[model samples]
Target: MEKNELKTTDSDNGHSPSETEKHLEHGVPVDAVNLPDPDEGLSEEERKRIDRALLWKLDLRLIPWLSLLYLMSFLDRTNIGNAKIDGLQEDLNMSNNQYNATLTIFFISYSVFEPLTQVLLKRFRPSVFLPVIMILWGICMTCMGLVHNFSGLMAARWFLGLTEAGLFPGVNYYLSCWYRRSEFGVRAAIFFSAAALAGSFGGLLAAAIVNMDGVGGKPGWAWIFILEGLATVVVATLSFWMARSCSTEKMDLQLTICQVHDFPDEAKFLSEDDRRRVIRRLKLDQQSSAEHEEFKLDYLWASLKDWKTYTGMMIYMGVDGALYAFSLFLPTIVQQMGYKSIHAQLLSVPPYAVAAVVTIFIGFVADRTRMRGYCNMVMSLFGIVGFAMLLGSGSPHVQYAGTFLGAMGIYPCIPNTISWTANNVEGVYKRGISLGFVIGWGNLNGIVSSNIYRAEDKPRYKPGHAVVLAYEAIFLLGGSVLQHVLLRRENAKRRNGERNNWVEGKTEAEIEKLGDKRPDFLYTL
Candidate 1:
């Protein structure tokens, strides 16, 4: 098809000629619908003003609620560590291995179900799906308080993972739907830093909750589960009113190319101008070849075949393994530093707090510089140094300082890594599957992490520190370098018009089915 003819037909799929003329009056060219350059007619000042307003609206409506939901998710997931120091193991007559097994069981279910849940999230809207799962997981977390034995705790944990499986990947996919690739890092960081803050808050909250040891014939550990779980249930219920799904139908109409499912438009929060500006920018940001596809299993299979998907998964696995182990076992690690259990919980706060601030800072810097791979490598170095300090020193003060370094290093990398993969992949279905697969496989690290820090390796837990440090050096650091090199080489190849053998003479539809492997699709390094 001729370029102009294709553009007109695509535009007619969603927008009328009158709408096209209206956009043209505001400086958008009707024939330039999917042009690589956009905002050509707006003044610099006007563009800045519009962007500021749009960002403010998005931040106000989206970030706080998503952060809160993630905070609750992280709390419910890791509060078991807090409950452990409060005597959960003793009450249930569990050994250290059995307790670790409970943590492992959660990840097993979590890893297995995450991809399926992402599919479900697409079938049901996020507004309906996210809250329903939150309520169910809330019930499961609350039930953990009532469990009297190892089998009961295991059952509660298994179900908790099943219910909570969709949240992280679902949220990532949702953010991708709204933001440009270049603009995604800071927003993702803001959302993910909640997990770090949750660590800090979980510690402080556990310290306070553990004091209710004798209230109403319930132990401190039981109270921790009961109170936090109830809070999640209440918040989930409230989310039914607060959560708004970005209308895919509106997005479809604006893009003129992508065909989206007919969703009820809930864009009342946005003014007409702001909404148009947002949509125009998003259309410009998308690759023209990837613009019109609907959700399909072919997209999923294409993503699975992309080698970058597995490499990204490796990076996520290494970093997430260290993160999960640290969050799940930090209190115990602190207690081993010669402090009482209560004191240990309080001491856990400073590192996480510092990490939270550093995480935000890194996010901003990463977005501004557009250097995710370099940022990831530098952050991984912080973790490597921190672990080295912990293993090298015997002093509590030095060990504590190491925690700060470790927290800053690992926490920032989580968002960067997520955005890194999200930024590179195209197509909604392909992006969804790639994210779900990366996160789901990455979480298997939780299983590996849970087993690494045994009671046998108490006090220093040198083996645990050593294992995490090696992963930081090899996978996190080395993987980023390799990814950067590979992407650069691929871009160079495309610039030279060197198509892969399989791509020759393929129909446009078949080539589009190639997703990220299209010669024009450049990887973000």
Candidate 2:
């Protein structure tokens, strides 16, 4: 209630009294960004309008551009496969082993760089940081066309990985800055479905681009890399200009889109009252008020100590193992079943199309129901049953149908699992690292998926099918159920005031720094 009293309370809590604590009273937090009550005296109608406008503007401004950014990332990553079929190996005189080595180098670079890039994501302006990396990778992709030997191509792939590593988890963290937990799943699904879009349509795009053969004295395969890489560069360039708000860059006093996007406190497009409304809702939703905490080394390692983060990663690994293995071998498996090479490629399209549609539907439902954990379990069962049918049945029809179930299972499970972790984690810095670690490390499941389907095991690869089935059923489904029970129990403990030690004898500002560990902060189930 008084300045002298505030310092005495904070000193007892073993916290030094500072400027931030001076304004904190008994139970009220002084916002990191000082403001009056954001919604005070507003009519119910006005509050509703501010909420609606914020979501609509963000959905328009953020989702589509992010989807395209991710689309390009997926295209550049996978287009190497298309290049090989278009005579990349023949032109470069590359051995099969050398070609395989090129692919492996990229993954190594990409996986290792993920955790570090998330730190940079927190430090820098995202508009500047994200597009800069896109340009770097696009240049790397373009250089592949000019390479004349195996070593040249390998070098380009490695750089491409280093540059592209940040886009996936970075976008997930970026969206969290603007969207509430309830709104995240569908946007993530839409953003992730860009991979499905790339898988389904990238071949067609490559086919058209490669037709530029001899137009610039390069082979068709070389043109594929050259043109696609240039396209990524062009789109990334336009994103900078689009950073000017539709509300108009000329609007007085507010920062440009790029500057405001650094944090909601700086939103150029939102009216002053509306912007504070956005920040207030987020603080309320998280049940913590440590807005704009300075970056600290402790934030990065905090996620490492949280068991929930590892459980999320292990569960995600189960989904990634099944997803990648199926994607890699689907065409070959179909070819072995007596279809022509081209015919199998065409058949592969339906599975991806089915996956893309189902993944979007799952996101909308997960947000509305808040049953994300149950959704993951249900989806994993689809994969388990799909793999079971493939292993047990002799019918081509049954095996063919298994592909659909597998696609449906793994695609939707990915977004649900990702958003599940994103939903529960609190604090910007900790979330940045948590998502980066969970996604970056989970993708290392690629190693297992890559190996399980040995060449000798083709034409109903029983070993691969069995291995993936166990991963999905045991890890994804089981982990989802386990987290649900644990989180529910923890929520009850907090609800019953059994966790009051966390808040006792602490200044409100010190308590605000607790993030998700605050007793009032319940884990999402």
Candidate 3:
């Protein structure tokens, strides 16, 4: 049993709550910092060694599988871009604008199902849930290969969107449960980097598949869909076996004590003396468990009611609108530069790759500095500059450079913003719902993104580029203002002797009984 948990409970006599409330009402300060460090008994070297081992466990257990799942999802959704250039349009005998309409259709389904999917992820274990979605989407993608016309294409895309709706937000909420807040950005980038890799891989794969044009009387574009879809199905099967949720849920799971030790060091900062005081305040024994097996189911509703929920949604929607637009259309944009299909696909690689690298670096820096809001603001500024340059420039080389900067600036900070929100909010239901709504709402921009590029704007795509640039600028301004406001509020609270507001709901006494949660649950700014 962990000492912190005991301090959080009502005193054995149950009268401690009233006494504590009275003291707080009188403005008598509680000595919150006088507690002893839980890890004070251990040497610094031992602590570092423990931290490293725990980090290794997290990487092995969670990061790779989560990243791979995200990679495939991104790949499956956008591979249509590759198929288009390989002759999907010609074979379907579709008009110039129909392909764009198909893209929009997917978002319609995607937006409708996203919030529901995120909420349901918790009901079933990841092993059962994620694999089911993967297999379904994979089969749909494969089925796309067999479609003879536009209707078939539209149907496949819609189902694909439906199955994929929950994946991003669900995984995000899942990751929050596993890693502490400080670790979120890097892990998220690691997961999202798969999108970059997928961009490169999708191009190479499309380039190779295009060579088989007219094989078996089917266009190479058809073969690409068939083969890629089959790959999705197979990969999804693997995910079923690999993906896991909580430690207690996996029957095959085997984690060593070294792995368990990676929990946040904030726990180590509490001592028996502090624990005793906490017990007196809220009142409980010193021995209790640090990591509990479950959390409240009602957290979901509580999370939805928070203003932070909508704020986070707006943040991601505005920033990610630009990110998704670029991701989905970059290959098409490159092809418009008059390069050969292969050249265009290959050219699309650098920008996404560069974005991935910056995202990873941003994660590490955010964790070390504990400054997510500032990092996000900086990333947005870069996006504005990059997009502005592209809108005005005509040179292929110069335009490509601008696109690269736009990609880099916007993507790196996005995961941090998401992780920031998840870390601040407690309770599994709230966390789950909050993550879902944030991601689901943000994804609605796909509706906007899909329509950004039109036949009327083709070749130069001046209108599409301009629209995204404006979107980026709006997001930048909004996020900057919101963060500033949040910071000022946080500062005011601290100055007014309201440190207890950092965690919200729980008074200092409740926190003592609940255990020093080590969430560092400060405001998002």
Candidate 4:
């Protein structure tokens, strides 16, 4: 309701917020952690070296475990592709409609639950909430193994969708809480690599697990669910400890209080020095005083009202339509390429494996160059070319090669887009909502892709390939070109002081609340 109609109470100062926020970290007590500051008795060179080491340590503790969680989440969600080829349809006596319904229903719930899960993730502890829901989903997957009828299968899938919805968006917000924007693309890529790896590993594992078809009188499809689902439960149990402070965190961008819930003194893994350095770095990197902000409905509304959120949604849709369709049907597609079911499962592994490596490589490139948009666009071209090969070529070998190119191009764009969106935002609640909707709405395309790859379009499913290719083209233009150009122009306007009047005469607190809109906050390309 003020002049700009966008001010919050935190933006009352006339000076840069960081200048005043140097020591005011997100509510972590200095004395509570019981260790000396890493800044003490150190030169700048020494301090930088120590900070680098600390980051590596944090990487070791965080990325691998989180990657595992994502791997399981992706595997459980998409492994049905493997199950379908392995006799789930014949064993369950399902018609084409029934099977597609299962896939469609899962995505409907998956998409619908994502935004709500994001809000809940913000309000609760990550360690408790993420793991608990993971356990529930694991149970759903395990129940999927036990389903003897159509209604039972439907019920299990619906619950699985609900419970598993929290993990992806929740983890994105969680990673954003710790890493700076410059470092975020790489971390998100690494986390996403797990999903790529899941596709590869899922195929390889399915080839072997299917050999157990008659073991305990259970079909291969049921065991795939039972075993993979059980593995998630086991991992969920370990997550309570493996995730450490990550699970208990509130996306606060500071891990000051450690991992032991309300007890700051109990987190044994991170010494006081590490916690101090981490919190200090966050204060420097962040634009807002998150310590002063709380969850408010207004923040959610602010995120929804932003044009960037919808832009991100459409951009993410560009690749996800291909990603979900391709991943969900790769095994079947391979089977249709004149291979046996077992060989199809085996062949599906390499494309995903290549995709995982390319995804990580592109992520680091985006980080080092800070060129998120260009990286996304360039990589997307690979998929565009690949999908064309699949649609135009009649040769099985050429179509098969297209799968690798497609995976390579499509997988990396996901993390790049997500990190770009995150980099462009400031403030906790707004950031969380943006991530949730961007990802959730993007997932709606999964339904589109899944349905298009219908039973009627076997062998060279020309329609499906064409649809994916179209989306890839959109990804290059809308997701990459438009976003890059817009942000680049916005940054130029700020640099030229054209938007300076928005911040003029505003107190520092009011200025702080302007977030990415503030003249000083440069948008990442």
Candidate 5:
């Protein structure tokens, strides 16, 4: 009788128990047309299903590799700063001002190409496109070892920027495809900490390579370029085999690509019978790629119309200008502290090490506490004071201490700012375009940093210090204003119960179906 009853139940629902199990595991709506409200109280099976789905999303393999890619990308870009102490300028016959100009030139190319790459990612698979660019840049970095003149150094610098142009923007876009908006900030921090780690690692690596200065009749700077470049190439080649394309990307996918392959079979919490009923109710067609159908230029139009885009651009530019200034010139700054060249390179390690730990810790904490704006404001204030202490004091110990505090405190907030944009933007294309534009355009400050520290101000580059201080002050004030504007808009929206034009077409009844959705999508506060 029991066997007969089981058979009857199986026949009633089209999905087998295994298929239902799969659906629940993947967070596929068991009843596809309308997902049940989590607050309505779930059946034991349904609760188990949600738990499994969350667990699957937290897979460990994805995090480490993505973090490594970011690490190498950042390390390769800034290792040039470490190279300066080991005869880089002398070998290239670059004047002090010419050296800075080369740094400026990299940003010109970087800024111009980033937005173009975002458009291109829509057509090309990231697994292939990103790694190819990585390999190419790695090759360019290696060539820096061979450069013997100002023009050679200039050419290498431009190509370095051109090849690396899409890395951060592309990676940001790529991560968004995998993780939902709520999860992006912490992940973004993990990836961005690679920049901080690179600072420390580059210092250590340079210290070791400087020991090779007289061994191969090559200057220590040449070894720095050669070894780091080769490392980049090797890592890029490996990443080609390891990195995953987006879940929907078809044809030429990597073996290691992370994706939920069988939504129906994976959901275990919903009964097989219930799951089948749900599948029958959903709007999705198994054969269709939602990404292709949903792709639109609407986001580009909306973002352009929004004043926030320009405001975001200014904020990014100020933050990056401050960062790149320190990254490219810290060794020079330390040289003024009376350390030998190699010793200066080694000393760069401690500040960045502290910065890395502080950045990662604070990023996750702020994200957990949901305090993105406050965290950023605090970082800007710290930077302002750090710069002030160095500018006003003559004590080498105090200045060094100020530099470390500034580096540690200020660095964590920039990525949060980028992640803030990622979380708030709704459309993929707009996210891509905005990210590319902000990152690329912000690099313009590299030019300013390059020129600010002229040879004339060797011991104290008073102008350079003053320039950054001014930029930070403006950022502090502007950031406060922008936060206030966003808060006011959010409050007004809540009070008036008005949806913007973006959400205007959708009925409130329809939008309310997404229970956890933040309709206002307020900027991080």
Candidate 6:
């Protein structure tokens, strides 16, 4: 069989060569040089075959492992709530306020250290950086089993938060590096569904683990921490050999790796044509040949200055506040509604399971339609209705159904928001910094969530539910709408030849230095 020929063209999105040349001569920045139109070189049948095979291979290789890693990270982080019901607070003689303080302290460290860790991840190789943090946090989680007092548990949790902060943002930046803007939603959704799955399975796991309370002279809650932490260590060790780092080549190409900074352009796992097609598609989508750009403080500054970054942070904060509150308190709320401890744990599973499925479906549709903001807005309505039901009703079954609406609504919005910001942002360092800052700032809401559901509020927790509901409304109706409008206006400006002053007469290197402010870059709505 003959290999396909690769073709490149100077025209981009209907811009003529003379027009581009005229713009360049007039000190106006032009988009990518020589964008490859890969589809023109192949028969439609061949293109379809390659697309299906390549995407399938990429999805199989990337999504499952990343999802599993995140699932474990979430499980370890939030399992304390499950353990609290299993007697962690009582055993440590912690008051309700002190217990809330412990949760708040973790987010304090997590929010503070997130950007720093992300910067370090960019400095180092992900294969090394990701697994190393996992191991460290796994150790910290294990140490939680040994803490006999509130102070000891607090110290352990603080360290765990520091270590775990990098994974979520790091994964978002990682996915953006490999996939095009349109392809990112589903991948991010699949990866984020792990958190929902963790909520579901964590409850079931706790229910079972608590049964071993009297085993080995340790409490069941202690065993829960120890066993889950040990499992994380084992997975982290395996990930050292399993997880692949971002490609080092100027054009992004997917390849599996076992160590730091190893990205072979022609790997044995893929055909030569397959590799070329992947690189071509990514280059055209990004409108640049470079995937791994040099890190600069200016990129970080640019991201900080970008209004989208702050708006994105606000959206995440609203959703995260509700998510953490519900995840941590659902079991307690269920128990308060006249259920036994074990029964509450079991009941928590169904809502999360339903959420996991809904999140994936929403992600698939969002990617297909390329309408992240719209999807997020609709999903948030589910949560608002759920909260309204809880607030307006006195019936137990009705409130139980409310949990399903809440989970389905809130969990799917997380991945959509993440991919929305990731899609609109340009440049590797800028995206990384934006993601880190957004996630870090978003976590500040954890402090609010922890305090809102006070022990005094007990069963109905109207104040906590109301606060979360209001935040969700702001995110869905206000923040997302504003962001979409801003993005559309910016994209129109780019399309209409309204150039940024900094980009004029600059080389590709100089233009890239402006990060997302490059005149040719278009923001995704």
Tens-place lDDT digits, model 3, residues 1-525: 111111222567553333323323223224332334344567989766755665574576667766777788888898888887777888899886788878888888887787677556666655567778888988988888899889999999999899998788877776665565566668887887787778878888888888888898878888888888787777766555443322433334342111111112212222344333322222121212212224454555566667777778777887778877888888888888788788898888888788888888888888777777778888887887887877787788878888888887778766877877775565555666777777777787887888888767767788888888877667644765686577558545543335543345665556543322322223545
Which digits, one per residue and each the tens of the lDDT, describe model 1 over residues 1-525?
001111222454664433222323233333236443345688999788868877776766667778888999999999999999889999899999999999999999999999888778766877789889999999999999988899999999999999999999988877776777777888889999999999999999999999999898889999999999999999887666444444433644222111111111234455555555566665455422223345677877888898889989988987998899889999999999999989999999889998888888888888887789999999999999999988889899899999998998799999999988988887667788889899998898899888889899888999999988887888888888888888778767754446444456666456545555655455777
Predicted candidate 6 versus true structure: per-residue lDDT over 1-525, tens digit per residue: 001111112456664333223334233233333434446668989888878888886676667778888999999989988998888999999999999988998899999988887678766767779899999999999999989999999999999999999999988787776677778888898899999999999999999999998898899999999999999999888777554533334323333432222121333345566556665565556423224567778877889889999999988998988898899888888888899979989999999999999999998998888778888888989999998887777789999999999998799999899998888777767888888988888887888888888889877888988998898898655788888788778767665555545455666666545555655556666
- For each of the candidates, the C-alpha root-mean-square deviation to the true structure, in angstroms, is 7.9, 6.4, 7.9, 6.6, 10.3, 5.8
| Total backbone collisions for each predicted model | 0, 0, 21, 15, 12, 1
Candidate 2 deviant stretches above 4 angstroms: 1-39, 84-98, 207-221, 244-247, 250-261, 287-290, 390-396
Native-referenced Cα lDDT, model 3: 0.68
Residue by residue across 1-525, what tens digits does model 5's lDDT show? 000011111455663333213222243333343444332456879766864564353334345566776777777778888887777877777888788878888988988999889777655666578778888998999998888888988899899999999888887766654454445677778878888888888888899988898667888888888888898888777766544433232323333433212233222333454344333322121111113323467656666765556767777777788888888888888878788987898888888888888788777876686666666777887788888877888778877887886686458877777876665554557767778777777777778877787779878777888888877778643664585477557645632334333334555443423211223333445
Question: Per-prediction TM-score, please?
Answer: 0.87, 0.86, 0.80, 0.88, 0.80, 0.88
At residue 370, what lDDT does model 3 achieve?
A: 71
How would you encode candidate 2's per-residue C-alpha lDDT over 1-525 as one tens digit per residue?
000122233355665544333434443445523455567788999878868877887776677778888888887877776666557878899876676677667777887888888878767767678888888999998998889999999999999989998888888887877777888899899988887777667656755666677887898878878887998888776665556433544634222332224556665666776667777766646523224668888887789998888889888888977877777666656666777634555666777788889899999988888888888988888888888887777677899898889888888988888888888888878888998888887676765665676547767789988998988988888888888888879777765556656677777667767777766566778
For 427-467, candidate 4 gives per-residue lDDT tens digits of: 87788789889889888788888787878877789998999
Worst 10 residues of 3 by lDDT: 256-265
> In model 6, where do residues sit more than 4 Å from their true spots?
1-41, 242-276, 287-290, 500-503, 512-515
Better of 1 and 3 by TM-score: 1
- Give the TM-score comparing model 3 with the true structure, all chains together: 0.80
**lDDT score at residue 375, model 6, on the 0-100 scale:** 87
